[model samples]
Target: MRKAIVRVADLRQQVYDNLKERITRGEFPMDHKFQEISLAEELGVSRTPVREALALLVRDRILVQAVRGFRFPEFGPEEIVEITEIRLRLEPYAVRLAVEVLSAEKRTALAGLIRGEIARHGEADTWVAAHRRVRAALFAPVRNKRLIEAIAHYEDTIHFMRVNTLQDARWRGLSVGGSAKLADAIEAGDAGAAEAAQATLLGLARDSFLAWSAENA
Candidate 1:
């Protein structure tokens, strides 16, 4: 991308994107302290804009300010289960809408997304990339932009937790199988099956996260 001539400050957006990506990738673990002065100095930015960015993350519930400083929010087993349950209820419905309204070209594009994911499966960052593609396909056909915007933020947060859960061999297997099942259900245009598969996949996520939290806690 070419540099713009005149506009809003690029540094702040750059800082925001970098911080958000790191947080999402679990580089900043939950409850890990975030030193604002250090980060501002490292990023070669003023504390003012960095403060703005941190506040944004806080509003998103991705980060929180503790007694000492700002840090990633820690989620327990119950919270993980609750979030997954909500996703199970909502995402399937979105997928069903996508299946119903997707054009032939869009469907082909989604198929290519699956193929792309298969090729990248061995890479360290592939799971999160693959998930974003799969999710975009599901919500692409939905007409409500407002609802999509709202859910997309939460989906990103959930994906962060999921990446951690998938580190387990058992959870990885469940994810692979569930993804295949969801793709097949979408291809078949079976809304009921699609929703069921989504629910089952989320159930696996919920159970796995809960178990991990129990062990860790």
Candidate 2:
């Protein structure tokens, strides 16, 4: 019975991860309703796990409950600006703190990830994953779990937008370049340079997102 329960929990976590990936990759249109039955059928899982996964997503603010069902949360221009502003404010400080405490082994690992991103180039998913690794490493030094989680939550909230921007070849090039610069700064153990590099990267992302939103609008 204990083994069975653990298996069920694992299945539910798998469902949650799959659903979150789809949502982040823009597989679901904005405000598209998520049906537990349909998702369960699609994943070949029981409705119980699907329902649990949806509840978890809702808790993460990735999905919203409507009268009809759960739907992807919709954000407009103002929300984008607000999210970017918050990221800009929090991330640089996180970088500063991380610089003070990053171990040489971790720094090397992060630099390798950035190099991998550059090599991956036009592959959107791989590039994004690599970029996330670097970001996660940079934030690893922050002692406040809540602050780190908040930054992660905000990043997840903007995942679709970020992925969309990354699809552009030009933008991807710029991102790789920025990542290289940031990696260099981190390796040098220069907090000021690392902070500046973080700002540059975030600024590029913010400007690209605003432009993309406007063009799509």
Candidate 3:
């Protein structure tokens, strides 16, 4: 019975992870209506696990239950701004916490992320990918698993929008400078400066996104 239970739990997690990745990569469009039966058929799995995984995504606010099936939720300006607001609150605190534990080796690695970003500035797609790497490096020093999880949850909500922001040359420049400033603060072990750097960049991103939302709306 225990072995059977483990298999079921593992299957559910696999399905959940798979669906999240597919959604993130735009395989599942916001207008794409899908149900457990179809997903199970496509994934060659039982509907039970698919249903459970869909429920989990719904609980995470990453998916919406439609009348006929499930679909990715479309974010409006308010929803997008709110997602950044949550991050703005949680991430700086995460950074401050990280300062207490950031090791010399980790600081070196994080500084390397800025240089990598500089080297790839000419590529649009790489800027997005590199920014993601910078985020992962910045958060690596935080020892609180739950805080890290919270930040990651909010980050996932705006992954595509972050990519969009980095698509612009001006935004990309600001972000590269921000990464350098962040590395300096972290290397100096200045928690206050680190927190300020995080908040300032995020504030700029939030403002930039809002402006884009208005123009594109």
Candidate 4:
């Protein structure tokens, strides 16, 4: 019975990952309602797993309860600003911790990842993946598991908004440049410069989101 329960839990996690990937890729329209029956049918799964996955996503703030079911929450300027504030506080501290603990080899590896992403300018998905690797490198040395988990959770929650913002070529270019600068600072073991680079990156992102929101509003 324990083995059977473990298999079911694993299946539910798989469903959750698949749905999260779809949402991140913008396959589902923002604010579109989700139906557990339809999703289960599409994925060739049962409603129990789909229902459980949806509940997990709702807890992650990636999905919210709607009148009928769940919908992806639309982020506005204010929401973006709030996310930015949290990122600015949390990320720079992470960078500082990273600089203190990262070995020279790890720094070199991080630089390589940043350069690779910079070379792949127009491919949003690849760039985002590489960017994530860079972040993981920085956070790898942090001893506090809970802080690292919080950072990862925040990143997942804002995944869609970040991807949508990168859809703008100009913003994408600026983002790559910021990453390059950040990588350089980290490689040099300059904590202050790394923190500054993180601030610049988040500041540009915050400004871009606010501008887009104002224009749309």
Give the Cα error of residue 107 in candidate 1, in Å.
Answer: 2.3
- lDDT, candidate 2, at 101: 77
For model 4 the TM-score comes to 0.87
Ranking by lDDT: 4, 2, 3, 1
By TM-score, who's the top model here?
A: 4
Residue 133's lDDT in candidate 4:
61
lDDT (Cα, tens digit) per residue for candidate 3, span 1-217: 3555343348899999998876654454446787998899999999998999999989988888999888767678788778878988999998888876777777666666667776776346567767776777778878889999998898776655665576778777777788778878887788899899999888878877777667777
> lDDT, candidate 1, residue 82?
77
lDDT of 3 at 97: 83
lDDT of 1: 0.72
lDDT of 3: 0.78
Model 3: ten consecutive residues of lowest lDDT: 1-10
lDDT accuracy of residue 31 in candidate 1: 50
Estimate the TM-score for candidate 3: 0.81
Cα-lDDT of candidate 2: 0.80
Better of 1 and 4 by lDDT: 4
Per-residue CA lDDT of model 1 for 1-217, tens digit only, reads 9987876766666877899887765575555787779889989889887888888778878777877668767776667767776777677777777777876666656656665675577234456556656666667778978768767777666655666777666776677678777777766667778778878877887888777777877
Q: How accurate is candidate 4 locally (lDDT)?
A: 0.80
